[model samples]
Target: MITAPGGRTLDLANLRCVFTLQGWTTSQWGSAVFKIYNLSDDTANAIQAGEFSSIQLIAGYQNNSGILFDGKIRYSSRSLENKTDQVVTIQAVDSHDAKVYATINQTLGKGYDAARVDAALMQTFEPYGVTRGRTAKMPGTKYPRSKAMFGRSTVYQDLLAKQCRFLWQFINGQYVSIFEDASLDDVIVLNGRTGLLGVPTQTIGGGAVIRCLINPTIQWRSLVQVELQSATTGYFIVNSINCQGDTMGDDWYMDLNCTAHNNLVDKPHKDSSKN
Candidate 1:
């Protein structure tokens, strides 16, 4: 018997059920079925219709929420055909959807195909290394000086690579040092920052900058000579920038001012705070 969240009693306790044992039949497929009674009690509505399919249940006490079962159920269907002979089919049950479908599918006309489900079991997830990684967004210095004689741009390839690296951190719980080269393992480029000027200079200066491949994400210093005095030109060390990792939360990219520190350059006496 499963009680709905809105205090509706969808009674299935009286329904006769059957458990299908697989592997005894074949190694590649496993299946089970349950028959629910369609009856209405004087106090509560009987199982007007019950259907479930391909639900995978696991046994564990999940984090004080209650016993936890997490997995995808492949198929499920439920409907009120008639008060007399209601038919239902449920497959591929996961702990997450039990409530929604368990409650309103009869009214919602929803069903999932169990056989068509895709499944992958992994021992671990390392996005940049063996696992796949992804990233998106336009890249470039957000500040306009990024264009005029007062502005500069990070290379598109470098920025995109860094952005991809940043994404890996988001998914894989790791960080690539912006100070390091992207050619190193676990690094990717973001094609983020663009529409800005990144012309190579005959000379290098102290304020040369690099942007994270993921925009508003991170930046690195590329001063040909950090010791250069008052010179404002150089090939921004495109490889030096990496994602500014988030510590307290999941927004390593949102805190741009801290990532690229672009706005800081736009301030007066840009050399005043050269830490």
Candidate 2:
């Protein structure tokens, strides 16, 4: 679903979307590209004129569907494909992407602890539509003297995350901080019955790369349970996910790059199990 300016909503028929997610690296801000076909001239013009500000892509069954991508549109272009099909392409970044290059100049008085510093940071980002989400416990470090902060917000966030040994990123307009190996409590079981598409392969970094039917429940930092014959069966943390969907084509799927949650890598399971 794409929301143009003035609160007008649009439901496109011919659509293709790609949404990618990586860990807390500033360079890896969640991004999405949307291609819509045969849009009304007015709508296309609005999008091209920078009036379309946000988009929401949802997937899955009626009762199980959830938001797959919610982001801010950054650019849009209109083109004629084959001289008949009108195609409008929109490029967007995560809501927090603005903060990646946003400069901040602030000072914290002496005795400000990590929690206070985090609160200040959140306050700074509120104007950009960012809100606080789940965050890892920060170190109880307190400043002995006034702390002056300057330069890009991403830089300061990176420094803070490194000091706390946590990974920080914006997910769905909310700031999230979590340990590198930490997994969410809710586990999504994957198997033949649960939309696991093909055999999961091992990446060079000892992680697993999997393809499955579009599952909205799969997101960054999610815990996935793999039950398959050729892959190691255990819990894995979703480090990256690439979601692709086409309303008029056979292209709905998700590619996930996952790391073993506990480094559990026993021999491949010999029996086929249904979960």
lDDT of each: 0.25, 0.72
lDDT of 1 at 235: 22
lDDT (10s digit) by residue, model 1, range 192-254: 232122322232333333322123222221222111233442222232222222222332221
For TM-score, the strongest prediction is 2
lDDT of 1 at 243: 28
Predicted candidate 2 versus true structure: per-residue lDDT over 1-275, tens digit per residue:
77865788777634544344333333256878777888889888977887778887777776688877778888888888777888888887777554665667899899988777667777777778787877777667787998888887777777777776777777777777776556666778899899899888877777888889888888777778888866557767778787777776787788888776446443222211111
Give lDDT: candidate 1, residue 261: 22
Alpha carbon lDDT of residue 93, candidate 2?
78
